[model samples]
Target: MTEKRSPWRAIVLVSTISSYIVGGTVGGVFLGLWLGNQFGAKPFFLITFLLFGLATGFYGVYRAIEPFIGDEKKR
Candidate 1:
């Protein structure tokens, strides 16, 4: 039998993924600032945030696709 997903699942999934994206941004900029201050790095915040966003975005996309890609399709 095929499994079914509750409509709420999409809402929850979107919310969760949005948070991850936000976290990546925060981590990149804040972490960069702190580390840069301590190590005198240039554009630390910007660079960190950029890289973090890329990685986090990819991860988020992968996770978002899980339901659709899983062995059992949820209707």
Candidate 2:
């Protein structure tokens, strides 16, 4: 028999995933900004780091959700 997933589990999963993406992006941007300020190359560093953060965030989301995707496919 199929069992219902707990709401708490879903909430936690969503929260975790969102946190991962947001954290990566924010961290990257801030770090880039700081570095850029030091180097006096604001836009260059900011854009580079922003893109890197976006890639990292997406990758994290993909990895985190992969298992769930596999499970759904099996069913």
Candidate 3:
């Protein structure tokens, strides 16, 4: 028998997911900015890295939620 998760667990999970996305995007932005400044191509690197970061963030969210998803399927 599976135990039900607490509401606090859900809240914490949501917070974690948001943090992952935000941290990744912010980190990417900073890295892109630095690279752009070094290479004299601000807009290009900024957009490229921004998208990459967003994608990475989503991937992290997927990974974090995968276990819960599996549990639901089992139920």
Candidate 4:
């Protein structure tokens, strides 16, 4: 029999995923800004960061629901 997961585990996982994605987005934006200066390109660092955050958020939501879908298939 599979062990049951606590509600806190689900909460923590979701929070962790969201945080990591947001942080990665910020880092990417900063990198873009720096590289843009080096290459003399007009880099829209803010736009990149926002898009990353948006994409990651969608992924996070998908991940959050994935466990439910998997659990159902096992039944």
- Each candidate structure's TM-score, on Cα atoms with residue i matched to residue i, is 0.68, 0.85, 0.86, 0.55
Best by TM-score: 3
The positional error of residue 60 in candidate 3, measured at the CA in angstroms, is 0.3
TM-score, prediction 2: 0.85
Q: What's the ranking of the predictions by TM-score, best on top?
A: 3, 2, 1, 4
Q: What would the per-residue lDDT of candidate 3 be over residues 1-75, giving only the tens digit for each residue?
A: 224577877898899899989988998899999999999999999999999999999999999998788666766
Clashes of 4: 0
How well does candidate 4 match the true structure in TM-score terms?
A: 0.55
lDDT of 2 by residue, 1-75 (tens): 244357876787798799888988998899899999999999999999988998898899888877677565575
> What is the lDDT, from 0 to 100, of the residue 1 in candidate 1?
28
How many clashes show up per model?
A: 0, 0, 0, 0
Go through the candidates in order and give the C-alpha RMSD of each one to the true structure.
3.6, 2.0, 2.1, 3.8
Choose the strongest candidate by lDDT: 3
Give Cα distance to truth, residue 74, candidate 4, Å.
1.5
Candidate 3: where are CA atoms >4 Å away? 1-3
Backbone clash total, candidate 1: 0
Query: Could you give candidate 4's per-residue lDDT for residues 1-75 as a string of tens digits?
Result: 244467777787778777767766776677667766776773575566557766776687677666766665676
Where does candidate 4 clash, by residue pair? none
